[model samples]
Target chain A: MIEWSHWLPILAMLPLVGGALTPLLFRHRPAAACFWAVSVASVTSVVAIALLLRLVDSGGFSYAVGGWLPQYGIELRMDEVGAFAVPASLLVLLSLVFSRHYVARAVDASRVSFYYALVLINLGGLNGFLVTGDLFNLFVFMEIFSVSAYALVATAREPIASLAALKYLLLGAASSLLVLFSVGVVFAMTGTLNLEDAAAALALSSPMPAGLALAGLATGFAVKAALFPVHFWLPDAHAAAPAPVSAVLSALVVKAGIVGVLRTLELFGGAESLLQPLLHLVVWLGALGALGGALMALVQRDIKLMLAYSTVANIGYIFIGLGLATASAVSGAMVHAVNHAVIKSALFLAAGAMIHRTGLRNIDDLRGLGRRMPVTAFGMAFTLIALSGAPPMAGFTGKWQIALGALQAGHPSLVAVLVIAGIVVLAFGIRVINALYFRPPARVAVASATEAPASMWLPVLMLTIASLALGLAGTPMLEFVGPAAQSIYGTLP
Target chain B: MNRRRAGRILTAVLIAALAVPLMYGMVQLPAPGHADAPAHTNVSAGYIERGAELGGSENLVTGVLLNFRALDTFGEVLVIFTAWLAVAAVAGTASNAERDPVPPSPVVDYVIRLLGPFIAIFALFVIVNGHVLPGGGFQGGVLLGAMLILLSLVMDAETVARAVSARSWIWLRATGVLVFAMVAVMGLPLAGYLFGLPDEPGLRQVLTVALELGIGIGGGAVLAGLFFAIAGADRS
Candidate 1:
């Protein structure tokens, strides 16, 4: 008689439920809609914290909706793996509360309301995807987030936004089709779409069907995760989207695919042996992406574009961690995912504020703006330090763990790659920082420079604080993230 | 003037050059597989047998809709709801305009008035016989919404707005899902999953009907809402 099971799922739905109701209740008052969105997200943040506490104390719980239970109906399973996602998703939504004013100034009125709705839906979808125990049900929520994301980008109404949306749409559709094809193959072989059931079936089956399914599923996730060659749509989409959308997309949405792949790996137990060569390929591709994305970012003039390319570099780091495929590496990857989201969101929002307040899109135009907007400049600086793996910051913690994990796995080359990429990151970050704080500002921006509204600064500030907190509280955070990795790697004992 | 002509010629030549490879690639690749596999068990045969056992109706599609894939249908209804809200936000029907554009022309209005009754009749038929028929909430809802979009095109946005606002549509959609989820939940302590009530045919039949009707109303309103929003934008 676990009471928490029922209540947790309900709590997850509160933001979604509020989002669904907001348009109706605040039909004529768009401002009220925004306020209500914040309230719902804030309430959800509290609930998520409570759930995190419960999970830490008692471990995790699973509840079957409608009481049909697994093998017959959908189930929401919350293990340590799922628990990690809850707080991350809550953190992303809470940041949106701060990103609202930036969005309001950047996007049109209709698009603003729609963007809030989509963000709420995205939060629900991401959380639902993590908690779900059923494979096909995961696909359903993935589609929900994908569709919302495509629409959200297009809402920018810039020509570049449309082009980016189109590219993302095509790539997303192709990736989804690949995923569906894998599900079909797996279901055909096992006669079940439930994760546990599929695992049970896989344990008894021949290698062929399992191999085919793994190949299809990995390809799908690789495309979504923006690994290597499939990374094309990412730079454009992130660069072209409004700052808040870019933040959410880079920090959270892309990680959904990473979560999918990790879940697949954990479920199918030597699902790896079937694709061992592919995993090696993933290592090299990730290394290449990391090096290439950083080099490209170094040459970019547009501040947002540089951050967008840097995200590709960050994603590559995540991939390298995953490809190591050991307990330590996987834990490193998960922690990095959380760390990257916090820092990346902060950076993007700060960049957006800089652009909005001064009407300057290029780094060269943002010269000596620290005097004009010290707070935004500081926020950007903090995120930059974290992104560059500075001491006592979230980014440093993730990189330290990953480097140790790489060394442990005997892949010392990856350490070199990480170091080189870190240098590239540092160089570009200093470039932006110098442009903002040291270089002489262009007369135009010097005249117009002012701070963005509190709505915008708040999210950016919270994210930067989170990045610092991650560094300072690395131990406790590692306690939770470590077990989550152990769960996925099947090395809990 | 000559430069413009030269530019047009250059563009045309580039297009032709691009189209050659595009056409060649389109023909050479293996076609996409969109068809359902035929190797599976004849689902219809099992469906027919079960349909008969459960006081089945003639519509096999409807039976499957209200039975096998009811949850997917529930989500489908939500997609429509999302579209409706999206449209309302775009239209701004409540402010700035007191009246809708003029009603449809004589011929279009005549056709709608003639078809409206029959359309209403068909919707009810689909909703009531969902457990026995091929058309369920989604298909029937689309049909209903299509008629409304058509009506608005011939009539005006104000007429449709007067009939229903964006606010009402969201309420209707939420109510539908809540009812469905509740019914599903209520059955949990007794029946199991939302629609997984029992093998005892009668209760399943009743639950199915109730769920479908709710979906139908929701589906219809969502369609109208979206159509109204798109049309309303064009009007302004």
Candidate 2:
């Protein structure tokens, strides 16, 4: 019998191969392409879920590609971080289901198959990035997902989409170059591309090159994650992409950057002197991003832009938890990564459904849509509240833990930033909710709009329910990522 | 204008500040090509010591690329394919209405035609001999792609496109990913791991050659497809 560990590589390969065949087999038949893409994602989700189950049952495991040892070849490992493939696959699946209707209008008909193909390829890249233990493989998978994401941003028919995509591509390419350069640096210093082996070597190597690698990696991933000070490329790119595309970008892609940082921390875990200052600096950056992103979101007119800035704010929260380097803080950050992904995707998809039905994107323009498109409107309103850190919802769990962590770390002032940012988040959420429900219909489309099709609203409703469920399951979720935090940071405060 | 100039100056100053530590880090690294350098002493030493016997190819680079770490190469191949997909998805395939106004010069066209067959032969040799020689799938594929582009430049793009059907073109472009996937799965049952080469020398050589061919053909087709999409060829 084949060991369950063997399925690890399949988690990534299945989607990649399925995606590669999509355009070949269903170039003209877009509906068939969507069906094929969703089926592949569904299967990938099953494989990822199975791997997660095995990981929980037996702890972490690694598979050597091509039967070579880890030191000599690529290794795909399933750990708590790799378990992220579960949500990544499921979100991509929902987005694909949602895209069946959304893409018909948002993208050119000639490119529908290509769009589905790119999404699948992007998922494959993310899965591969999550599981791989080799430094070079990490860079390769990053490019795979990064390239597809840049292209997906351009698939929107809007006039600004290409420009936004160009901006995204330019920055993304530069970040990727930085990462590749760091990989080269690590190899030069250590002579091994294996993460475990390199980490061992880096522990004994000179500090200067190791520090450079760390800085290069941290900056590269920060750009990808859209952390403050380098986040200028995010608002336009996320806002201009199609809604489902935005959901994937906001939900999974940015999280990959955080994962990259976690991997960097793991690689340099032995070098505490190098990490201390970096950790301290990121806390301030995270605080600035949290407050600044929330404030920026509060002022946005475009609904998607608001959601985009909200993502930046959530990323800030995650970073703060990471920077604290306490058990509760780091675990809270990891849990929040998943929670925020679900909440953000729900918001984007609901916003997408509204735009699909009414062709309006302004918060004020969507007045009184609650009664007209009840399911989509309710999903959006509910997720928006949850996004603002309301109790018994996904956002609250992470914030509460992160706050407790701040006090534990003796950084009580950071709690003020959290609270103020949370309030600003709530203010914007309430503003959108008020316009959605309390105000009178201000546009003809809002007054006349009907509910979106089942394909669109069902995913939104499912994610809305998931956001609530994940909140209740927060304790167990925290425990699940507990060991990961310890393993990544060596020892927490 | 004054503000822009100030911004540029500030950017320069910041870059210079950043460069100081970067240069310090670079200068501290062990010199390249030294016997004691980590690059020479670590994992590569093992690769050099036993690669021919265990890695299944005489050329250590190809052996490592196709055997030891095939997954990275697979990702690289997919990246190339995705690049073509992105181009086709974004800019779209060329329409019939848009055509090149200036025709190719007769002399240049004839010379390209004369050289195409020889280039094709050379690329195939490079691809097939990759296990022992310096050239490999990527190098050979680039050559093959350039030949196709050269042919397209000299001939009517439509006539060149008609060389293969629209349906066939996509399959050709996907050859790298499909074949790599097939080989990867086959490895699980045959060699007990994904992407493994069989222990049998003949079978391993066949699989390696097959991989080189797939990557070469797929990469060349995708490259030509990219040129066609950008140069206003048939929409296929």
Candidate 3:
């Protein structure tokens, strides 16, 4: 009876069942754990694609659990934006595929199954969050993924990893509580947890309670997304986490917060008094984050940490687009979210491969690797160019769209912040390119390093190619997400 | 005033000043128990009026928790399970059979021995009656977990270890989410949609009870496992 249209929820749950089985199946055969995890995520990706196509064909759909009508029962809703789950799951799959050799080397052998299990669980939580329409359901899904992320970040077994994970755990848990508090407030105001119902109810009600609830939800998501002034914990946590885990964290987990913000905008779009002010705040904070994060990235010598800070900056770019609250701007933000997920994961995996080959984290230590690890070097270099908002890569399309959006919205000053931030990011990226391709080896390990195995580099290369393909053929993505932008802000550019 | 004192006072005043609007908003909220309150006039009224037929549980709370907002409950179950996995991943799985057993305390041991069976049965009763009564899976599971911890507290570690192997503990702790997910998906065919219960009142009742038991058992096992692991009771 489900046919193909109702497949969105299944795409989320399949990885969950696989997560439940992975540990038990690989109790003695730990190697199979990675394979099991990839197979599950791959299956979820395929189904996600099928679901995406079906939803596009049929337009959009919603499934109310237990056949109970909305405003009463939980709903699983999918529109163009929710289809972001497709890219999220595919990126996670690629990360897991890259994780096999990396985890075997980076993590303790005995704990490999547990690591893979957490990865699958994180994937499930993310996918579920993407499609859920209930506020409390979102909180619950957020917790599911955040808890696993806290754990997986520490799986690296380094002392710093543990400390950073603990910090992340405390902050993340506090933010989730804030999110829950906001959900409670919204429920109290509207008496319905379904987002569309609540939004309609909020539109009819006074602005005060909705405003407070908005404050709570904004702070919570801002913390989750690592927005400026609240991103204090990201660099350490992302840098200290295992490379594969870093890829997942930087690429998808951070985007979860921005996704939450967009959903909130869509839900509250009709409440102009509330949304207008919040969107203004989002714009300023995003501008600050873009500048601050890039400056911070500019000072970091560790390539992973630099990537981590750059993630904070890239997040700023997406937020600025989203906060612009215009059709083209939000579309750019959405497109950027997808592009960053691809390019950043490629960056992390490629950087992870270098570290795996040479055990060096500092950019200077990894100098001359372009000659040694040719494919990985190419991946790292190309991702850098793409990420710095240069031409010929997918990253430029989103930034351009956002800048163009600023022009459309009559806020040309924000374009200044975008350009300045881009230059900072570009400068940092160029330094790394210089080190990787131009500078002489700084250590013996760098001079003697060999190329990473195909299991490791293959996914990185695929992602790099994906980064190019998505950039060059970005019109389809923009068109696909156009309706989502229109849903929040009525007209399109 | 000194600069530091001035700064501190200024900061406090600013914070309080900022909070005035929020406090003013709260003061304007509808009085508790008002008939026209949003909480009563909106969706809660529908749940109370029709949750039984719509959600298939006598207890409206359970109806909401299990059927109306089943995905939320599903997510809740995943949260707990993920917590256990996170802790276990950071701290490896325990092997109590190899550990040095703590000596049993005589009087406390006798007390737990007498109370353990009754507590176990009571937990089961709570879970089964959850649809009609106040107690449910989470409460029953905590009680069950408390019983095991109490047993571990008063008696030898070996007894608990013999009763539940480390491997069994992992599966039992995981059973909650695994079962919940399986049932949610199974709803597609068994009923009509994901997490949809059969419209038949009888079948819905059966599945809810099954879900309750799964949650109870899984929660209890995880609580015990998490505690015992943290207490160093199961460390090899």
Best candidate, DockQ: 2
TM values, all candidates: 0.84, 0.98, 0.95
Q: Please give the ranking of all candidate structures by DockQ, highest first, separated by commas.
A: 2, 3, 1
Off by over 4 Å in 2: B1-8, B93-98, B234-236
Which residue runs of candidate 3 sit more than 4 Å off their true CA positions?
Answer: A490-493, B1-24, B92-107, B156-159, B234-236
Candidate 1 residue pairs in clash (backbone atoms < 3 Å): B59-B132, B59-B133, B62-B133, B104-B154, B104-B155, B184-B194
- lDDT of each residue in A1-493, candidate 2, tens digit only: 8878788888999899999999988988899999999999999999999999998998999999988999898988999999999999999999999999999999878789999999999999999999999999999999999999999999999979999999999999999999999999999999999998888888778888999999999999999999998888899999999999999999999999999999998899878888889999888899999999999999999999999999999999999998998888988999999999999999999999999999999999999999999999999999998998998999988998889889999999999999999999999999988998999999999999999999999999999999999999998999999988877876435
Error of 2 at A134 (Å): 1.0
Q: Proportion of native contacts in model 3?
A: 0.76
**Candidates' RMSD to native:** 6.1, 1.3, 2.9
Clashing residue pairs for model 3: A394-A471
Index of the highest-TM-score prediction: 2
TM-score of 2: 0.98
Model 1 C-alpha lDDT per residue in residues A241-308, reported as the tens digit of each score = 87877887888788888888877776575454654666677778888998999999999999888988
Model 1, DockQ value?
0.15
Compared with the true structure, the alpha-carbon lDDT of candidate 2 equals 0.93
lDDT of 3 by residue, A282-316 (tens): 88888888999999999999999999999999899
lDDT (C-alpha) at residue A132 in model 2: 96
Better of 1 and 2 by DockQ: 2
